[model samples]
Target: MEQAESLALPALLAARAARNGDAVLFSDRKASWSGAQALEIAARRAGALAAHGVRRGDRVALLCTNRSEFMEIVLGCGWLGAVVVPINTASRGMQLEHILRNSGARLMVAETHLVGAVHAIDAQTHALESIWLIESGEGGETHNRSGAAAAGASVAGTPAAGAPAMREIAVWPLPPLGEPLAAPCIGDGDALAILYTSGTSGLSKGVICPHAQFYWWARLTAGHLGVVPGDVLYTCLPLFHTNALNAFFQALVSDAQLVADRRFSASGFFASLIETRATVTYVLGAMVPILLGRCASAQEQAHRVRIALAPGVPGHFQQEFTERSGIALLDGYGSTETNFVLGGGVADQRAGYMGKLVPGFDARVVDDNDREVPDGEAGELILRADTPFAFANGYFGMPEKTVEAWRNLWFHTGDRVVREASGYYRFVDRLKDAIRRRGENISSYEVEQVLLSHPAVETAAVYAVKSEFAEDEVMAALVLREGAALDALALIRYCEPRLPYFAVPRYLDFVADLPRTENGKIQKYKLRETGITTTAWDLETSGYRLRRT
Candidate 1:
């Protein structure tokens, strides 16, 4: 019985509470639990993180949003062996003081309106040491970034003024569900959760993971989206990333029933996937063109959703979003330091590749001298796995960026793909988001899928700027469709016939959004540090001339 990949989240919640202790599993818009009430709320949230002085490999952090007390502090920091760290509630200042000082964590639960972005950081730079909140307005108190409540605070212990340089941190409140604590001696390669990376070219590393890398990312993404047992997986993407925290470990090792939501609402996404009867769901890649630029409703083919996984979608919006939402999106490839290594299952999917290469992992693609690279050419993918710690056990306190991204024994994945001798793969771009111009090379994901197949484009991005012959130029940042107008020279003559006249967009802008990263990605290094902005638009100073057709 100890084989769920060497069990870890406190023996995988005591073997799913000894085989489905009253089934259910988890839900969100407030409640619902089961598997013996999620193993008795992971032992009363591991006895309220050991009465606040958290222990095992410590590091707590969790800046809330997406509730059920953020999955009971990630199952009470994996039933008290401790490591959680979730963050990205749209972080803040110096990337929330470099993730609370590179996760030295020291107890941070958050969400009484995000503890005023942790009392505006700088409490001697970080390693927090207090804050619990989660109560939401007045009773949980701690407000201050002008949303009121700081005069001799009203709940817990307080001491939280403007956490300046050397001290005063405290702030309490979120405690109850205390005495239950049992499951301790953990393993399955320990470290369960550190996450972090949407650094989008800098700072955010963290990774670590282990606990058999989220039990092989919920047994290879619930066996590539055919997640079974009582099905229902939904996810409005943002349990602080790793694709909605591995869709809550693929509905806890597939006894399936997750529902999460606390975000992504393209007009309440098909009435919350028809009131969560969600037969496996989850999205990303500009949420499939923002639910295919909204408007077609009758809740877009109503619900009982069938399939979704959807990693970076856009192979012509995956068959017009599975023919306008009878679900089925698929596509793959993974990364919070890998697992679900590539994908398959909706009868081994293909349209827009990323699959083939899963059997206990080991990939290649190479070329910036790490060799390999031949099949269909593009390079840099790497990988390795064969299971052990499954994949990520490095980059926490960044030991030289985890030996420069796991040096030779592979794991690089700075991404760039193309394998194809029918073994699939495809995805070309993000080898630091490639875009050379004039000397060609572009693919900012194929010019943001030809500026998201135009029709008043609602969310493009496509980057790279520097050119004055110094190289890179493309640029884009769009977002139109709400009373849509579009004309940055008619979106560069609709990307000069679907791109390649030097990948069209010689700078555009139009934004009302797109600088994402709290798990909706697209932070193209803050639009390459807000580069050509004198109200953008340029195209070689408006003279426009692309000929090569």
Candidate 2:
């Protein structure tokens, strides 16, 4: 499949299915799809979407959890030349509304458990005319427990003629298999997905990824993992993010099967791995430590997994996990815009060093003016791909952001790194004031926006405080309204439903006021430097527990 990178998703699937029709392709608790079966399902779904008036270039947003059906719908959209917008399951309130409006999605496919979150979306913000609710369980809110089916369901305030239609479909429903439709017009450059990523500007920006982006993402990462036919690529990471999508690409391109689970559970991870007999997977950020903290399970050693594409593992933990599990932890560095741009083979991988730049891209550490920094000096890492559309096309609906990011002919990563004389690059810090908690990128601006929405809050400055393990813990310094009587716990409870679990501030301080610059902008550097004072409200100690769905 040398021309695989140039083939659109539909063409890629056809090629694979023809060569290995009966091969097992995708799996979940519900069922497994074969190579031929996957293509048939995708085609029927494409037909279903067409019947729903989803046409070329139309955007279909998916808010379902980690299930094979998500991939099925994505592939269907790909075949129809429709853009697939994956919404973060953790997002609710304004965050959910923003993505739908920003992407201008005509239809949404969300699971039953997520109906409450969808209820929070502002119906007036966009021209969304339809919602295809997928039943998650027998007793979910949107599920019709009376064993009923319907053509469509009426939504409140929807126009009788043109307003969005809301309909419920079964969880992981399989449309009738039929002849796959041909989309000769859909090419590699056609838009495939709009992955929402946190920006330095607080509000999340949707990164437009073309079909070619995912194709190469799979081929390259699959090569790095040494994937072969019959290999089982496993990932419990949510499909909303690029990491798992890349893993999905690996399976599609390399003729490997994919075992996608519902979500990551640190306690049951090893057991899951053993059950899947996975050969390769991904472990990001604190997951490595969390897995290590578990009691030594026989299942850990029983799994056939050989390598884990750990992008952000600390050096000491990398060594310990490798030694203990007898599985190699390969470290690399990348972001949503660009897939992995740097890495090393397991034979030569270095702890904390992000290895040499991957082929098909040019990378440099540069100063503010875009001048290349001297080796061994800390500076912003910028990358330019040799192949066209290898990185994200740009930020959706934000040409200014796209232009600003691609300035000076390089995709500015806003990450601090040091290129040593030995030619290995080590991550230093995030130049942008973003926080990485667990594996999620928390925009300080977004978090602060939520905090400011509270009635008692007057001024809020949210910043990242270094976590004891690694990455960051979100901290907020707030100045309450005059005579306002509110506690940190109360404000947090207020933000519980409004913000994602990861975005909620773990440490809160109600200061007299915030430090500002002459331009009247809050100086977050000063707040971060203030560190955690004794008065800071510790959410963990305050008995606040977050339920991760």
Candidate 3:
């Protein structure tokens, strides 16, 4: 199947399905879609979306978990040339509302369980034109017309259509499998999707990814990761993120069967891998220690997994992990803003290095002035690919922010690192106050601001410290107000309901004073160096757990 004329994702999938109609394309517990079956579902979904007034360039928000519907919508949106906005299912009412409003989503497809959360924001958001609930049952409660129509009414003594009525649209079944749809008139510059960054770094910004960007990234990833057609690639990462989506696309491009999990579970990981006979899988450094800490069994080493693609693995644990698990751990470095700048495939395995830069991309270690630093000198990592089509279009709705990242003709990755003479890059730390935990980015400034909201908290500084397992873990250093004696449990309780789980500081260090620079800025580097000191209270270990609070 030639991709020259049909470079769009939908067209590519369609062409592939036509070539391999009966091949198993995707397998999940809820459903298994063959190549032809998936293509038909995508076509029908495209028709349904188009019938609902979704057109080219229109933003359609998908707030569903990892399931068959998610894949169908992703492929279908490509056919209609509409930009898909994949919302994080973990986001609360306010976060969801911000994304919907910022994206100016004309349509929102939410799951049955999330209907309540969607309705909570329905009254406040004016941009949403329609809300379609997935998996609605026959005897399900009907949409409240009063509540739905009331959204159009003004709360400020004026009338404004806040959101359209939550309607139970008919489920469109998959159309008869046919030859792949002919190539649509699309270009490398067309906006394909907007993946919002995890709000760990302040408010999340929607990263604009085009069809060409995804296609090239997928190609490079397949080459770098050594993905093959017969390989059964298993993915548990949320599809909303670039890593998961890239994994899925790379598998598809290689004609490999994808074994998907609704959500990642440390306990069920090995079982799923063995059951699916997964030959390859992607993981974050945080997951590595968690898996290793779990009760080791013969079955863990018995799995057919040949490669574990991990990022940000600590230098010391690399050898121990490989020896214990009998599976090679291939570590690489990249971010949502830029895809696959450097990686080591199955063939290249260095102990501590994050492999050499891949073809089509240029990498350099630069100092504070953006000038190239000598080899082995630590500096900010900046990457540029010759193919502009491979890079992200820009951050959606934020021109200044987009320009800031893509300035000087190089995509500035806010990571600090050093490159060795062997071309392998070593990650030092982040220049931006962003923390990477469990493959998720968390902003130190954002968490600090949230912690400071407590009445007893005079000031707070958040930073990443080395966890016992291997990767960085969130740790907070806080100073209580004068005459106030708030303990760690109270502060943990306060943050439990306010922030996402990853953003919640795992270790709390209560201090009388916080280290700061002369300019009055908190010196997170110094705090990180000090590590976890305050053992006055261990909240996470104190059995103070809340179920989805």
Name the top TM-score candidate. Answer: 2
Total clashes for model 2 = 3
lDDT, model 3:
0.73
Write the number of the candidate with greater TM-score, choosing between 2 and 3. 2
List model 2 lDDT by residue over 1-549, tens digit each.
245435588887888898887888898867899889888887878888887788999999898888877987898899889999999888977787788889998788877666556654546666567677676772474444433233254443222345466332222333343356666567777899999998584678999999888887888788777899999998999888999988877887788998889888888887788888899988887888888887786777888999999988889898888877878988887788987788857876888898888877799999999999999999999998887777898999889989999998799998999999988999998888888887888888888888888888999988889876667898999999999978778888888888889889999999897899998999888877878888898998877698544
Best by lDDT: 2
| Candidate 2: segments with Cα more than 4 A from true spot | 1-5, 138-151, 157-179
Error of 3 at 466 (Å): 2.2
Show pairs that collide, candidate 1: 34-37, 430-433
TM-score of each: 0.30, 0.93, 0.87
lDDT of 1 by residue, 393-455 (tens): 888887987888779978787777989898888887766766644323345765676677788
TM-score of 3: 0.87
For candidate 2, the lDDT comes to: 0.82
lDDT of each: 0.76, 0.82, 0.73
